[model samples]
Target: RKFWALARTGQGTTLRGNDQVNGYLLLATSCDGTLATTATPTTVRVVCNNTLTIALDGTTRAIKVPHNTRFDPQAVKKQLGIAVSQWDTFMHRMRTLSERKVQWHEAMGFFMSVVCDVPPNSKLPEVLPNERALRKVQSLYEGGGRGATLESAQGTAWGLLNAVTEYVDHERRARSTEYRMDSAWFGQGAFIKQRALQAALQLAA
Candidate 1:
C-alpha cells in the first residue's frame, strides 16, 4: 500500500493515508522503551498507533505532530520520560479496574453499553454502523483473540478497557489506519474510551 508523507524528522517519517493528517503513523527510535509528550517547538501527540498507541515503540505507530513544530529527533527523544504525576493517576485507575472484578457476562454488557452502536457515537455514521459497532465491541470482549482472551478480558474492568483500546486502535474497521488512529485519539473511539474510563472509575468507586 502507498502512504503520503505527512512529517519528516531526523528520527523518521510520519505517513498519512492522505494529506488531511487527522492522524498518521510514526516511525522512530525506541528511546529505550519510554514514551512521553513534548511541547517546545510545538510537538503534540494526537495519536500513537498500534501497540505504540498504548505505549511507545521503536518503529511505526500512528500520531499527529503539530505543523509548526520543528521535527528535531533528538529534541523529541529527549522529551521521552514518564509524566510522574499523570502516571500516578493513570496507575490508580488501572488498579481500580484490576481490583474490581466482574463476571464474563457483566463485562460483555458493560462494553456493549459503552461502544457507540448509535449515531453521534458510532464511528461509522451510516451503513449499518450501529450493528457494526455492536459486533466489533462484542468480538473484542468475547472473541477468541489476544485482547479477548478470558485472562485479559473476562473478569476485570482493566482488562475490558485494555480490550477496547486495543480493538479501537488496531481492529475496528476504518477508511484507513490513519483514520483508525484518529478515531482512537480524537474521534468517536476516543469518546468511547472516555466513557469506558469513566465507567471503570465508577466501578472502582
Candidate 2:
C-alpha cells in the first residue's frame, strides 16, 4: 500500500531559482514482505517531475518497520507527524543551498565524489570516475538539465544536487521504464541521490 499527504500550506514553495515544488509525506508498505513499511517526506519538482526524499534531520530520511514486525498504523503516523512538522526546516536548508554558489571546478569535484566508485579497502592507485555518467551529469548541470537555468539552481549547490537527481530519475540507463522508476525510488538510484544530497550539503556548508 502507498499513500501521500500534501503539505498543509497547499501551495508549492518557491525555491531559490524561482522554481516551485510541493512537499509530501509518503507512506508505503507491502503485505508480502517485499518492501518495508516506511514513512518518508519527499518533494516533487514541478518542472521535471523529479523527486528527492527530504532528510528530516541531518541524516534521517524515513521511519521504517521491517515487514517481519506487525504493522502498526498509529506508530507510523506518530513518526510521520514529527517529520511533517520539520518540512519548514528542510526547506530552509534547501534554500540555503540554493543561495550558496558553486564554481565549475567545485561542481565537477562534487559530481566526481558522487559518481565515482572506490572500494573502501581497495589498493588501487586511482579509480577512474564514471566518465559517461560524469559527462551526462556535467552537461545537465551546465544548463542541459531540467530547471538548470532556474535562479535557484544556476551555479548553486541546489542546482548541482538537482542535476544528479534528474540524471538518476530520467536520464540514467535502465532495462525499462518500470525498472528505472523502481531504482529511482527504492534501489541503487536512491542511494546515489542520497549521496549526492550529502555531498551538495557539505559543499554548501
Candidate 3:
C-alpha cells in the first residue's frame, strides 16, 4: 500500500537554491511475517529524491509491532500522533546541524569513523575505513552529493548526514532496486544511517 500526506504545519524548508525538503510519515507492514508494522518519520530532498529518517536524540523514532502480535491501528495512531508533534524539534535540530560548520578534515574523520571496520582480534590501531565506500561518501559530502551545494548543506553537519543518506538510498550496490529499497528502509542500510545520524549529531555538538 502507498499513500502520501503533507504536514499540517512547518510544511518544509526551501534551500538557497531550487531544492526543497519536506517531512513524511511512512507506514509499512507485511503479512508473511517478513516485516514489522512500523511507522517512521522521514524526510525527502526534492532535488534528488533522496530520503532520510527523522531521528531525534539518536533514535529513529519509529514505532513497530511484530507480525506475531495483533495489530492495533488506534494504538499505532496514538504513537504516530506523538511522533508527529516532534516535527518542530527535529527541524530545529536539523537547522542546528546546518549551522554547525565542518572542516574538510573533520568531515573526512567523520566518514572514517562511520564506515571503519576492525577485524576480530585486531587492535584499535588496526581499524580501517572501507576505502571504496569512503571515497564515494567523501566525494558526495565534498559537493558531488545531491543538494551538497545548498546553503544549508555546504560544509555543515546536516549536509554531511544527508550525504550518507543519499549514498545509501541511491548509490550503494545492490542486486536489484527492490533489494536496495528494502535494505535502505529496514536492513543494514538503516543501521548505517542511524550511525551516521549519531555521528553527525556528535560533530554538531
Candidate 4:
C-alpha cells in the first residue's frame, strides 16, 4: 500500500475507465561479465523481483519493494517533495490575491507565464525513473530545483515575485474602487468608513 501511494508520483501510464492498463516496463538490466548500466529503450516491464525494506524517515512508515523494481525510491521521494513545494508556493501567492478580491484570471496568468519558460527538451522520461529523471521532474516546477542554471533559476524566482507584487497592487486599487462605490451607493457600513479613514491616515503618513 505504501509503495502504491509513493509510486503514483513516478507513474505516467494511466488506466482509462472501461479501458486497459499497460504493465510496468523493465528500464534497467545487468548481465554476467558486463558492466551494469541503465536499460536501453525497450518494452520490457521494469519490475523489482527482490524485496527491499526501507524505513522512510525512521517512522512507522516504510516502503516495501518487490524484486525487479528498477526505480529508486529515495530519488522519487526527493523529486515529489520538490514538485509539491513549487505548487505550494504558487498557490500561496494566489491566495493573497484572492483575499483582497483580485481577479482570479490575473493570478492564473502569472502562473502560466512562469510555466511557459520551462525548456521542452528538459522534460523527463515517461517510464524509466532515476536521479537524472527526477532532476527533469524538478525542472518542470517553477520554484528552485537542482537542474536550474544560475541564470534561469534566479530569473524565474524574480519573475514570480514580481508577479506577486503586481497582483498586490491591483488588489489595493480594486479595493479602493469598491470602497468608493459602497460610500456612493449604500451610504452604510461603518467598516468601510473606518477603512477609508485609515487609508487617509496612511496616505498622510
Best by TM-score: 2
Rank the models by TM-score, top first.
2, 3, 1, 4
Model 2 TM-score is: 0.85
Q: How accurate locally, in lDDT, is each candidate?
A: 0.47, 0.80, 0.78, 0.27
Which of 1 and 3 is ahead in TM-score? 3
Best by lDDT: 2
Error of 2 at 92 (Å): 0.6
Who is ahead in lDDT, 1 or 4?
Answer: 1
Models sorted by lDDT, best on top: 2, 3, 1, 4
Q: Count the backbone clashes (under 3 Å) in each candidate.
A: 2, 3, 0, 15
Segments of candidate 2 deviating more than 4 angstroms: 1-11, 56-58, 68-70, 118-127
TM-score of 4: 0.18
Score candidate 1 by lDDT. 0.47
List model 3 lDDT by residue over 77-111, tens digit each: 89888887787787777778888999877787777
Error of 4 at 148 (Å): 38
Query: Which candidate do you rate higher for lDDT, 2 or 3?
Result: 2
TM-score of each: 0.52, 0.85, 0.85, 0.18
lDDT of the structure predicted as candidate 3? 0.78
**Per-residue C-alpha lDDT of model 4 across residues 33-121, encoded as one tens digit per residue:** 13232211111111211111111121112122334557687875664354333423332322232223223333233333322322223
